[model samples]
Target chain A: AQRVTQPEKLLSVFKGAPVELKCNYSYSGSPELFWYVQYSRQRLQLLLRHISRESIKGFTADLNKGETSFHLKKPFAQEEDSAMYYCAPTPPTNAGKSTFGDGTTLTVKP
Target chain B: SAVISQKPSRDICQRGTSLTIQCQVDSQVTMMFWYRQQPGQSLTLIATANQGSEATYESGFVIDKFPISRPNLTFSTLTVSNMSPEDSSIYLCSGQTGFETQYFGPGTRLLVL
Candidate 1:
């Protein structure tokens, strides 16, 4: 069974401060991880993926296989970055099915 | 990525009635999945809609309660039968275009009273 755990339900940070949203997963096989963001009154959209090895909106996540964690990080927080972030792990067998963790609401205070 | 659209962006339904949500994709996709997101909760996979065949539901979901149909590669529908207050949630459809990343629809918000 694939499971994703996001320990924090809410996180608040000051503008220009670094932000980190922790995510851990339990899967037997090589896992594919993703970070999804949903803004207020907006649809959920993909923020980044482990396979891409790229950063978007100054946010990046590195898959730590040893730790079984893929935490999303940003160098500096901005008010516009406030949103709900979800960590998901794709099942190795099912291409479409993904196990998602309870999202963390990020509030960037100006 | 596929451009997916869902009809009835939102609705307020009475208990004991049923609501069918429709999902349409711009291009052909191999896999289409339905998910439910309760208020302030994580997304839950409800079923996998396969073209020309019956949908494969998850452990906690059943075909009778949440009927799904995928007549073609670009379209699918999910029907919530015998709705109750507990059934109120945001229903989303996602499709994978032979890729590891899945694209999602806007989602249908159902409020059962």
Candidate 2:
């Protein structure tokens, strides 16, 4: 069975402060990890994927195979960063079958 | 990324009634999937709609409860049959655009009264 776990349901941070949203996954085979963000009144979108090795909207995440964790982080949180973040890991053997974590709602206070 | 749209963005229906949600994608995709998000629960895969074939449902989900159809690569439909209050949830359809990138639709909000 494939599973994705987001430990925090709600995370509040002040603008200019650092933020980290934790995510863990369990899969038998190689896992494809991704971070998806849904801004207020906006559609769910891809924030970043570990395979790309890139940053999106100043947020970055490292896939730690040892820990089986893919935590999203940002140095300076912005007010616009407030949104619902979801962590999904796709079982490569399956046909794009993604296991999604219960999303974390981030609140950036100004 | 692929641009996807879902019809009946939201609907309130009576118990025992059924509603069919439509999903359309701008580009032809290799795979299309349906998901359900219950109140305060994680998004779960309902089934995978295969083109020109019957949908493959996940564990705990059955085709009699949720029938899915995909005649082609760009369009599909998911019907919630004999819905109850427990069936009220956000139904989302997503398509895989690249090797591992899946794009989602806006979602259909269903409220079973």
User: Which candidate leads the pack in TM-score?
Assistant: 1
Per-residue lDDT of model 2, residues B2-95, tens digit only: 8999999999999999999999999988789999976455678899999999999999999999999999999999999999999989999999
lDDT by residue (A3-98, candidate 2, tens digit) is 788999999999999999999998888888999998877777889989889999999999989999999999999999999999999865436677
lDDT of 2 at A4: 81
Global local distance difference test of model 1:
0.91
Q: True interface contacts reproduced by each model, as a fraction? A: 0.47, 0.50
Cα distance off (Å), candidate 1, residue A49: 0.7
Clashing pairs in 2: none
CAPRI-style class, candidate 2: medium
Please state the i-RMS of candidate 1.
2.2
| Cα RMSD, each candidate | 1.3, 1.4
lDDT of 2: 0.91
Worst 10 residues of 2 chain B by lDDT: B36-45
Question: Can you tell me which runs of candidate 2 are displaced by over 4 Å?
Answer: B39-41
